[model samples]
Structures are given as structure tokens and as C-alpha cells.
Target: MTRKKGPKIVVIGGGTGLPVILKELHQRNAEITAIVTVADDGGSSGIIRDYVNVVPPGDIRNVMVALSDIAPEFKDIFQYRFRSQDKFLAGHAIGNLIIAALSEMRGGIDPAIRELSEMLQVEGHVYPASAQPLVLHAKFTDGTLLAGEAEITAAHKDIKEVWVGNNPWSENKKPHAVPEALQAIEEADEIILGPGSLFTSILPNLMIEDIGRAVLKAKAEIVYICNIMTQKGETINFTDAEHVRTLNRHLGQNFVDTVLVNTEIVPESYMDFNRYDEVSKQVVHDFKGLREQGARVISDNFLLLRDGGAFHDGQKVVDELMNVCSNPIKKRD
Candidate 1:
């Protein structure tokens, strides 16, 4: 039986949220291009970036593992974390190390990432939003300026504005877009933003000037997969409407054409996780306000906490996105 090729889809985001979407989308015959965020400043990525002076490869590693057409053992090996009193291997992922070594050998991030993708046999292409090591500078509501991803995330302060550093670390003379990423956006039949961290995972990609321009220029239907629960430090009290507003502020006024939100009520029994309680679990979709913003809402059972942590039901979300793409409507401008 021959499977029909699905739509060409470009997903832009980073972290765990993106891999979940990529894994589900790969199940379909869609041509997937993942534009990953590279602003990470924590964990193994931070260690490597500080020591080796390269783009943080953690998100790229996650996306590769998610899209690889390999055995579960392979994925586990890539994701394996070493636990030791040894300072070097303490909390690093094996995949991160592989990426770091490749980057070092290849002279930069672009070639290293390309080699890793080929080695993984990834079903989809993954590109960094920028080859540069970006410092996420934020102007807090209290008028204090915070620099570096770690400092901004830890400050726990309300961000008024954010921008990339004056001198970003890409090899390109200008902090340019990944040509492949931009091409994917231009040719995409649909573009999906994430159910990921609002400020960190999703918005960081948009901070790239060329990527932002490509998104605005793309003719494909733009969709946002709203997060099920608010992020603790980043999106503290953000409602679904507020989330859209924040993204729109970054991408522009009439950016997203549709929003996929979770309307499924989570079972109380599934809410016993300490992490859920810490983040104040609750659905935050604002259907009325979403419509008011000229974006229609597609509500569904997106919440699934299998191992006692909140997560999107990847297959369910993918199914809904496919349905929406098949039945396109003229977006309200």
C-alpha cells in the first residue's frame, strides 16, 4: 500500500514540546522541517557552549532523536544522561556530546548539525533559527535589564521587552536566517507553532530577524498549538489570550491564523504530580478572545500526562492539525 504524501509542514519551536509534535507529524507522510531555538543556556548545552564556544545543540539533538527512523534503543542511547560525581559527565546527554564533538570538528554549527542529521537518518530536516549564540536580553517591567538566557529565566521578573545581542555568534556576516529554514517556510503548506514554553521555546525563534520576516511572508496557514498549562517563571499568569497577544507582539499583529487549544478536562487522578501542582495546572484557552483576534480556535483533548507530567497528546494534536489543513478556510485578516 502506498501512502499519499501529506502537506509540507514547517514547525517552529524548541525543547520537549517540539519533539512531541515532530514524532506525531512523522507518522503522517508530511514533509516536516523543524526550525529549532538555539538560545539555551542551561544543562549540558550551557556547559558545551561556554567551554567550546558553539551554538547550544540540545534542542537540535532532541529534534533529531524525535524524527529519527531508528530503534527505541537508539533514541534511548542518544537521550541517555550520565550520573556521576565527575564534573564533566554529571548531567550531560550523550547526544549533546556527539553534537559538540561534530561542531568542533566541522568548524561551526551548520556542518556539524548536517552531519548529525544524516547520521540519525532523521525523517525531517532540523535547522537552528540562527547559527549565532544569542543572548536573550530582556527589559524587565521594573526597568532592570537582564542579559543571558540563564539570567533572564532565573530573574523571575516580568519581561517588558526582549532582543538578541548586538554581536551574535553566527558565521554569517549578518545574523541571517538559515537559508533552508527560510525556504521551508516559503514552501510550506502549513506552519505550526508550539505547545512549548512561550518566552523561551517559541518566541526565541521569532527573535531572529530573517526568520521573523519569512514567517510574515509565508502564504501558508499559520497555527499555534497553545500550551496546556502556564509555564512557571516565564508565562506565570498567562491565559490563552495573553499567550496569543505575546506571540503576536513578537511576530506582528495579524500573525497566527488559528489556535489549537486543549479543552479536555484533565482527570484529577492524573493531576497528582508534584510538577503539575507547582505550575498550577488548569486549561487557559480563551475561545471568545481568540475569535476576537481574528483567529479561530480548534479545541480538543490535547492533554495527556502519561508519566505524571503534563504533555500534549501528540497523535491527537496531529490528527486535528491534519483535519484543519485538509479543510482550509479563508483566514480573517
Candidate 2:
């Protein structure tokens, strides 16, 4: 008798939260593909993108590490960032530099990731949302427009919407998804989005035309791991339903099939503002609002608090995702 294979899952997002979920999914031996945002234009990724004119490597590198079978010590060394004293490589993670070099040597980010994924013993696929570096543009609710992910983030206003286009350094190249990403979405058993920054990390990937279109029409059950907290600059007062609504609004339809929401309350005085600076407060729940957007909510005590901050329990979230794959919710007609 042949052994059974696990479900095919395609996760779309960026930032620290994405890796946590990926790491847990890899442990379950799920067939995973991470479509990371390349609209980043800050930190080490920004410096490399500016100089090398390649897609930012930060998110992709993190995703690769999450899905890798490499030794623990090696993972640490890869994620280690230089101190300010190291003037030449200050604040840059070793993995970022390595990825940037590979991108140049391989002539494009997609090929570079493929080569690195093999070397790192990655158990899952990692693809940038766009083939080339994307310049993130936003239209604010105040009728203002800004370019660059960093600039848009720093604006700290209500973001009306966001879209991606060619990086200035790319001679006005257009943004398009790699073929692998499209294929992964087309064949996936389930699709997952976020536990990351609503505007910056998650939306940039979907704004790519081909990717967005594919997601809109995908046959798989799409689940969202909603953020535990509302972000200051992006989602200051956003509720769980609002988060899902915002996603639907951006996609021009209610594409999300299920949402994992945390019911565990963060203590009033327990929040350490110093550590989680950009966080405003816990994400308020509105099950009715979620239902209004055609999403079935799986509410649970899924919050994990540590180091004076709040986050989704990756184990719990992955458990829910696995359950969702096997027992998909019946969508209302």
C-alpha cells in the first residue's frame, strides 16, 4: 500500500508571523509553498535592493528558514544581524546578504530562492509575490498617495488601499507573479493569509494582478489567521471582522472562507507598550461582521503572550489550519 500524502497548502503573507506558522506546518509535513511580499524597502533588504536592484530578500529568507530542515544553530547564524559597531554590515542579517548575493549570481530572485531552498534543505517552496522587486503604492483615506512600503508605513494614516508596480531601479518593469506561485494556488488544497501587518505584509502580495486574480477564483478553501492586535499606523481600531472586511474590500469580493479568531483577552495592564510599540490594542471581535462578509469564524483562546507582548499561538493556529483542510466549512450560496 502507498503512503498517504499531506494536504497542499499555499500561504500568502510576510513579516515575522508568517514564519512562525510555516515552521509549525513544516513539522506536520504538509506540502507548503510560501508566497512572500517583495515590496519591502526598509532595513537590510532596502539597502540591498537599492544597490543591487533585486527583490528584497528579508521576507523570503525568513520563510525559507521556517521551512528548512537545517540544524538549529545554523538557523540562528543565518538570522543573526550585525551590531551597529560593524559599520560595513551594521543591522544586516547574514541571511539577507547571502540571499542578495544569490539573487545577483542567479540573475533573478525566483531562481536565487530555488537554489538557496535546496541548499538550506527547505522542505517547502518559497516564491516572491512578484518576479521583480515591487514598488508599493498606497492611497490614503485622506486623499493622499505615497510610494514605497517604508514611506507608506511611516505615514501613519488610514490607508484607503494599496497596489504594487515596477521598482524605479527596474527601468519601469511591470509586476507579475512567478509561474510557480500561480500553479501552487491553482492546485492547493487550502490557501492561508496573514497573521502579519494587514496593509504592508499581506496586501502587497495580493495586489499583484495575476496572483490577485488567481486567488479571487481559487477553488480551495481560503482561511485567514487574523492578527491578535490592531496595529497603530495601519489598523488602529480594526476589529476581527474589519480585518476580514478590509481584505475583501481590497480583493473586490468576499474571498476569505474561514477566519481563526482569538478569544483570549490580553490583560489591561499586561501590555508592554515599550516592546510592542506599533501595536494599538487587542483586535476586537465582531462575529456578525465576519458573517456579513461570508466568513465562518472559528473563535478560540488562541492568544500567546510572552516578552510583554501578544501573538497568535502558532501551534493552535496550525492545528486549526490542518483541521480546516480535512473538514472544510460549507459555504453559503
C-alpha lDDT of all candidate models, in order: 0.81, 0.89
All candidates: CA RMSD in angstroms? Answer: 2.9, 2.5
Candidate 1 residue lDDT tens string, 1-333: 112366888999987889998998988978888998878888888888888887788999998888888789988999998997767699899998999899889987889887887777778788888777776778888899877777787777777667665234445554666888999899888999997877877888888888888888888889999988776557777778888888888766778888999887766667655755435556566778888888878887787877767789999999988887776664423
Q: Clashing residue pairs, candidate 2?
A: none
Question: lDDT by residue for model 2 over 4-102, one digit each (tens)?
Answer: 358889999999999989989988857898999999999999999899888898999899998888899999999999999999999999999999898
Regions more than 4 Å wrong, model 1: 1-5, 166-174, 267-269, 272-278, 330-333
TM-score of each: 0.92, 0.96
Name the 10 consecutive residues with the lowest summed lDDT in model 1: 165-174
The top-ranked prediction according to TM-score is 2
Clash tally for model 1: 1
Candidate 2 Cα outliers beyond 4 Å, as residue runs: 1-4, 171-173, 330-333
